[model samples]
Target: MRFFEYQDRARRRLTLLLGLFALVVVLMVALLNILLLYTLVEPWQELRRLMPTAEMLAEHRGFLLWTTGLAIAVIAGASLGRLYQLRRSGGGRGIAREMGGDPVDAEPEDPKNRRLRNIVEEMAIASGLPVPAIFVLERELGINAFAAGFTPHDAAIAVTRGAIESLNRQELKAVVAHEFGHIRAGDMRLNTQLVGILFGIEMIALLGLGMLPGRRARSDPGEMRGPVWFNFALVAAGGIGLIGGRLIRAAIAREQEYRADAHAVQFTRNGDGMAGALRKVAARYAGLNASPAMVGHMLFANGAIDQLLDTHPPLEKRLERLGQPLDEEGLERLGREATDRVRRAVTERERRRREQEAAAEQRREEEENGPLGEAFGAVPGSLAAALLAALPGELARSARNPHWVADLVLYLILHPDPEIREQQLHMILETRGPESEERVRQLRAMVPEPAAEHRLPLTEMAFPALARLSRDEQRTLAGLVERLIHADGRLSATEYALGRMLIEHLDRRHGHGGKTTHGRKDPAGKNARHRENAARYLLATLALHGHPDDLEAAEAALIAGLGRFTGSLPFSAPIPEELRQASQSAAWARILDRALERLARMPRHDRQRLLQAMDDTVQQRGDPTAEQRELVRMMAASLHLNVPLPDAGELFDAGH
Candidate 1:
């Protein structure tokens, strides 16, 4: 999906929007200054009647400059103040609250809401992103949904009550996929930023509104007439600023909406659901009266935007682009047909969803049997469903039950070695008590053998649960997981991946910084020698982990991977024995983390070179080993690269 490119475009658009906003603010200031000069001149003429022609108030020029500057300051200050207020509300949650949405539970009480939760989960799993919190705008009867957050980890998806009551299962799935597209392509952050920044520009209208009460007083016999004109000027200036802001907001939002629709079709591999949903929205343009002006551009449809400032493309254009071109008559006819079909299908849709979920429950093995290639970005819905199905019943329930999921994560880290297991078990028993012990014990028996591929998929499932943890509980859960891993006295690659995943997902929700490397510099070749050295350090670290017991094999793996990059840096020297010794220390964990971040931050081409070299290193023996596959996966996770798990069948010989 080229996250970097999408992010760059969003930033450029924001920059241009801000520039236009600034120009408007300047014009407003000029308008304000002119009004002040006119008002001041009226009083000056009154004084001129007292004194024949008091030298034309030359200092009025200075007053003109002063009032103009004051006007600029007032407008800028009000705008910035509004932005700060919105920013403090936090990203998606703030937007949801502003739109009158109610936060939903992972296991919602209502049956329909349960289906909504399921669809959201499927999309999150398919994309290898964390499950975003869900909300439903209960009062709104519009067929709309929007995603909001600075990143996927902190994102929330909100759907209108009308959509819930109207959309069938597949239609709802398409809507959720459309929102996920925004979350994935970094649109939500831009959407959130636009909401916050534009609020400042729109505050001019509020300022004008505040000046109205005094206007009536000015009409009294003793009151001055200047105040009335000033109030009128305030309203006019604010109206102009508001219009400019809405225009910019509408222009930026329309293109993003079109792209999001396309992304939905791409993600779902079909347009039927999206087409149906759009038809419904076209038929029902009604929106909530409470939808705030600041959020108009963030909605699935133009919630309450002026006709001239509509944030979404026309319904006809959007549907046509989705391969369901419809005219006025066709759109209305289709909407009626869809509404009837959705009503009839509701019961059947529920039945099908239940049956599919039941099959997943019965066929858990297929969940773990998907090709490793699906692990990267844009996971197929079938694979996503299989993985969901593969989850054991108890763990699956725990994933949906926010209350019991922390123990599931703790269960995965229980060591295999008897001694280490005993240590971890003791810690669990001591800190978490008998109930926690029982949960872990049952999972230990029920969890699959070797627990390699299953650990991450299971962990991914646990994200919703982890997200629901209280602050203290999250802290304690993190500490407990770390204690179990270190209890083994050595960090394995799988353990490292689990820890990173936990931190990356949970920390962001807990208010800890979880920024991605979208804007980081590609410092790869700027320091060619240093870059090569870092690459060697990374390869060496992975090699050692891949062949822990045999130092000779470890070195061989390193040499094999380095061979792929031979021509790129002929002048770089090999890792020294001292450096190799240092790489084996516990500190190597930190080194590898930094190395992965550096590689991830590099330009797309450089990142490809790095991954290619690592792949050659892993497949050097012409048969992919389990350790080799795992090392590659962990590297991808650390780099935040969503490369699909390598194709096991193609990469490995039979019975290697």
Candidate 2:
């Protein structure tokens, strides 16, 4: 099913689950009221002797109403308080820290952490999502991990030390993929809500225990001890409610785990990797030393072994689902084989480490010999490699540091004209203080002028750190970016692209941003016209920007792009005169801005077509310019497309 479908279904399931929790609360309140009537309300102590009359009922009605109201208020109040706490803590990153996780550095010194970071980055790039902030539970020695967040934009992935140290590369990849599955299926949001609900239910038991009778002076011979019995009854009701809550949470969590496992297989296309990881988890099961009642439902495996309340399915059962059912004897053999593989892998890794060190030293020596010698080094092959080649080392390192990232962003968007740049620097000083302004100046001196291609990659690298900022800080940074972009009084395509990408990404991470709702039924009538006009505006912008000197070429490129959506759009294609008038209007920027807002809501298939059309427009005049490439990347980011940035060769060949 599509992501939006899963999201809608999850919402329905959440409502049902919450209703079950409410039923548990109602039962507890009923029990409390019964205790109050039987123990406290002394109405002649004889309901059997009393007449069945309206006046008799009216006499006890007030007392019964008071007891029920108090019980509900206590329970509902506790639940709302827990929900408030979760909200204040800032979603996934906050949950990770609360569970004793430390943020993994972008350039980690530990080899294992580095490996985990690389794997996450690779998966994120392929999945077309922002790279989630990674954290390590340094104290946890259990093979477990979890994804937490309200939405994909703010998601965080955390793994224990044992998970990284025990699992090999493929096994670790499978585990991470399983968590990503949760993010994609909208399980993280549901898991977070479950945490709050379970906590509220458990509060009844805690309150009862707090109120239990303690050592007291000897009571007089006829003193009432009914309150003592009342306390015990409260404890009993609370215990039953807690158990019911756990059962409900576990049932829902078990089904989610199975779905996540299926997603892992789909993502990796290898069942053995996930199956192997599960077997190892079974063989080496160490409990997580955290609040099991609150976090268990979100973990990769059940943290404890309560059969009736375990959040994960049995390991054997999970293996069976993965097409690797094994008896005890087979499990033992697999465990032994896994141990042997780890030993061999360690040795191989050490050898590769040494080789890499030698290669790095050789490159340093070559780089020292000048550009000619540097050219002898390995050629840029992949997107990552090309980015590294284009970005200066200092700028790249700065992008990874949260302290310097905001400054880096400011420096990248400074106006090219000296007078305008000085105005921007002055604006930064007034708004962000002298320290920030100085940092931006220092960055400018260090890089002098970065190439056009390096801008987006640098911004992309800064995302994890950007996510670390508080909401207010992100908003301030966003404001600063906007002002700098418009400082020259005219927005370049590059400037609009860069500013839009930054603001949109930060907005989503703050949990208030609008998410793409793909696979929804297409809009009809007026809405359809609006969408068509938005598409036209975008295509016109790209064509005019790419071929600024030649109007004939611009019109041809525009037509070529529009042809991709010929049958799909609601309205007819615009003629050359219309295109010319639209491109020449002074309100072109405002039009493009509105167009982007509309296009961002396009369905998944429509988005893919739009991207293809963009590529066609860029390659209409042989090779695309640097400015053209940057604009395309920015446009894709603005639309929240999951695909990687297309290269020049891909752009040229995409038209066919």
Candidate 3:
């Protein structure tokens, strides 16, 4: 099945499972009502006539009503209460913290943490997702992990220490990929919802246990007897409901595990890596010792020992599906190989540590005497390295530092014109106070003029630090950014791009946006005209930006781009008068912003087509200008496309 189809199926299955959970709650209520009637009113003598006659019902109607209402209120109240708690706790971050996870630093010093961070960053960039917050469960020694959140923006992934120390790089990559699969499939939201819903069912049992008389009770025996028997009935009723909840959870979880496993293999294109990790889990099984019931289904593997309600499929079954089922002897050999791999990894890590120490003095000397470009060139070649090299050292450092990131962002938004920039700075001083304005001025002095190419990389590097800000602080920063953008009297393309990137990232991070278009279908043609207009406007905007001096060239570029969408969308090139009007209109920024947001909701296929058209428009006239390139990157980011940015060499070659 296609990616979105899989997502739709998962949603449908979750809805069905929720219905089943509701049925379980209804059954619990019925059992509670029957228990109260049999024990309190009639006893065993009237058990055979449980359904009372009209006269008997009339006599005990109030009692039955009270008992039934109490049961429903408890169950529903607990469920809603749990849901509210999860929502307030900040989604995935809350769950990770609850499980004793510590946030991984943005630039980790340890080898394992660094490796894990690198892998997550690579996958996120490759998949066009915002890099999720990473956490490590330092206390957990089990070979398991889980992803949690309401959406990609607020999502976090936590891995056990055992998984990091035990698995080889390839095996760990497979494991991380498995969790990403969950994130991509929209399973995290469903998993979190299940946790809250199931907790309510479990609360019934907790209430029963709390109500039971303790050994130190000093109540009279006669008075306690009636209460004791009723507590026992509550416990019995709750136990049944808990079991029912687990069974339903297991049924849904097992199928999801299979799908995620398949997704891991597809994403990594390496079945043996995933199969090897599973074999190792079977070989050295140390389950997580925390609240397994609450997070069992979300785990990469089952962390509890309840065979009948195991959240994951059996290892053998999973391996068979991957076409790599192993016998006892094979497992033993794989276990030995895993041990050797871990030992080698540890030795390599030590060697790298020593090498880094030896080179630390040389790096300091180079930094002291050489230019920033020369220093950057000395670093090894990689996408991350290249992007860092392209940025000014002080600016890049500021972006990575949580304390200085806000100041760095303000500096980026400061107007180029001296008069306008002064007004913007005055506004910052007035609104953010003297201390904040001083910091922004200091940042501007450090990087007198940041290049056009520095904007995208700088904004991206600041994301992790931005996530650390409180909701109120983020909201304040967003407001300050908007005021600065409009300080110049007219919104420039650069300003619009930067503002949208910042605001959208914050929106997703806090889960305050509208529904994403993952499983949405537009079968009614309700959005067809809207989408087409968005496409036309986007292409026209890019064309106008690319060839600002020559309208003829701009029209040619626009027509070329619209050609790409001809078969699928009803797109035609705009006339020169329309292009001239668009160029002079002050509302272009607002119109372009709305267009990109609407297009972001397009299905995967249409989005890809739109991106292709945008790229074509930018490249139509020989080499694109720096502004043209920045606009393309900004547009792609807005649409949530997974396209990777060009490396440092490419950026330099593009004349940035």
Candidate 4:
């Protein structure tokens, strides 16, 4: 699906919702002004003020100003306070915890949990996203799941026990894919914002509730009338806010749900799986109690209030869209397929385990040589599986063991050059102390080294463990890793990419400053000069680095890369003088960051062509050398594309 278009639409929807909120505030203010003016004026004066002939109502100007100010303060203060509460709760984690979900194992051992983990990991890697932490609501019997967080790395995926026990592998895969679609399309952030806004409105309703008990307690009958009127006004304002909030929620939720369903179909290429799961949801007639009513919109299906405050389209309509009608035979077949599929998965797992025990080495070699399918967009399941298999056993084990992950990550940053390695060791010793440094040093010696192709996968595996650290501990760890990477006095492509990924993921989890949505390209990309300039900077950097020894060949590569963009250029474009002037400094990192951010804003097709050009430049010397391959991979990762090293040809060829 066109991700950018989806994002643009989401932004527009957010704008519309905000406008609705402002309108509600204005209406509340107007109501308060009318009530306060009536309360203050003498009986005949109040009657005169209420007359339709009082067109401008110039005499009530003071009450209007006072009530408007009070209304604005109440709404703004409540909204701001609620938003702060949500932010402090750490995005989705707070919401999931509130729902009483227990954290599932990162690498689960229970057969059921393991099946779910595998499905989530497969979708994560396929979409070039971090494997989100999983949660399970074992007590809840309804089939439901949700994806929540400000960004992909920090996101959480939670499912009810009913989903796990009922849906087979393909059906569950479809469910998880739908959640991943939410993560990709920036729906989680928007949902959180909506929740905060609604909470503010709910606060007004609550205040009205609190005032009702005091309405009849006044000793003086005349005074009783005033409190009664005031309470009536409060209730009226709160009632409007409450009704308006739900209406807004229903409107936005219904549209996004449909988009998410389509996204799942596109990602998994299986309409029957999702349709079957929804059909099951309908047949079971179940509802989720995993989360509270406020979170109804975030679920795979509506939680409570499915009819009045429904967050999902009707099941029959969904099935019809997927071309799976509600025939009696089709329903029976779905149940049969679910049961048989589970049996097959168990048998397959047993058979694979036995095969692994007998010929582990042979299998490893075979996985390494197999074609690494589709590199640019969603990776094929086979390619993702192969990459996972290639992770070193020790590293994989450490990734699951939270206690060992810090030292393992520290060791991964150790430089290869002997002199630089010593400098890195000394820096680690100074910052982390002897004990922590020694643990990493000893572990480094024991672990088998990972190849260049295995770098990104190893990092991906370590993420769950990295997430285990407290926010402060993560900050310290990030600083130490940064010091070690730069201790060698120069940055290799592998180190640069790994460093970026490490900081990006950790900072996001800790709620540090990072883009909530993926697109960073400036609107100025429409300008021809701006586009060409960005192309020149990116192509020049790639060309100069790819062909360090031959200036002529470097210029040729630059021309070839730029040739892919709009507007013709000279046969050879000179490497911008800044590249040469700043070659000795770390300026290229900042330069590349700016260039790619601008380039990334382009349309998907244009970005693909740009990727193709870089591929062309890197392969100028027949096959790409190890250094060349590493450089390209890092560039792609920097651009938010996690492509497999060997699959670049097939990636571009398939027009992904």
Minimal lDDT window, size 10, model 2: 369-378
Which candidate wins on TM-score? 4
True-structure lDDT of candidate 2: 0.69
Summarize candidate 4's per-residue lDDT along 231-332 as a digit string, tens digits.
667677767876777777776776677667766665565677898788777655356754564456768986445465777777776677677776655666
TM-score of model 4 vs. true structure: 0.74
**Candidate topping lDDT:** 3
Predictions in order: lDDT: 0.64, 0.69, 0.71, 0.67
Write down the TM-score of every candidate: 0.72, 0.64, 0.67, 0.74
Please identify which of the two predictions, 1 or 2, would achieve the higher lDDT against the true structure: 2
Q: Which residue segments of model 1 deviate by more than 4 Å? A: 1-84, 87-112, 137-142, 204-238, 285-289, 303-307, 327-330, 337-381, 514-584, 593-656
Whose lDDT is higher: candidate 2's or candidate 3's? 3
Candidate 4 backbone clash number: 0
Candidate 3 per-residue lDDT over residues 1-656, each given as its tens digit: 23234444655676687789779878887787667766787755776885757776678889879987887777678878877877787777887888888898654556688778766654453233466788988766668888877776777888987789888777887788788777766677776667676676677678878898876345566667656767777887888988887788787787688767766664455678888889888876547778544466778886457766887888888888778876767767766665666567667756876978757557545543233221122122345434445567677656656766787888988888889899999998988888778878877887777888677766766777788888898988888888888876677667877888887777767655543333445443237778867787888877877776787787788887777755543344663353456534446777776677677777756777877787777778887776677777777767765444454434211100
Please report the TM-score between candidate 1 and the true structure: 0.72
Candidate 1 clashes: the total is 3
Q: Provide the lowest-lDDT 10-residue window in model 3.
A: 371-380
lDDT of 2 by residue, 115-221 (tens): 78766654553344566889988777667898887666777899988788788877887898788777766676666666676666566667767775555513442
Candidate 2 regions exceeding 4 Å error are: 1-19, 26-69, 86-102, 149-155, 205-237, 266-270, 291-294, 327-330, 333-398, 407-460, 467-476, 487-498, 504-656
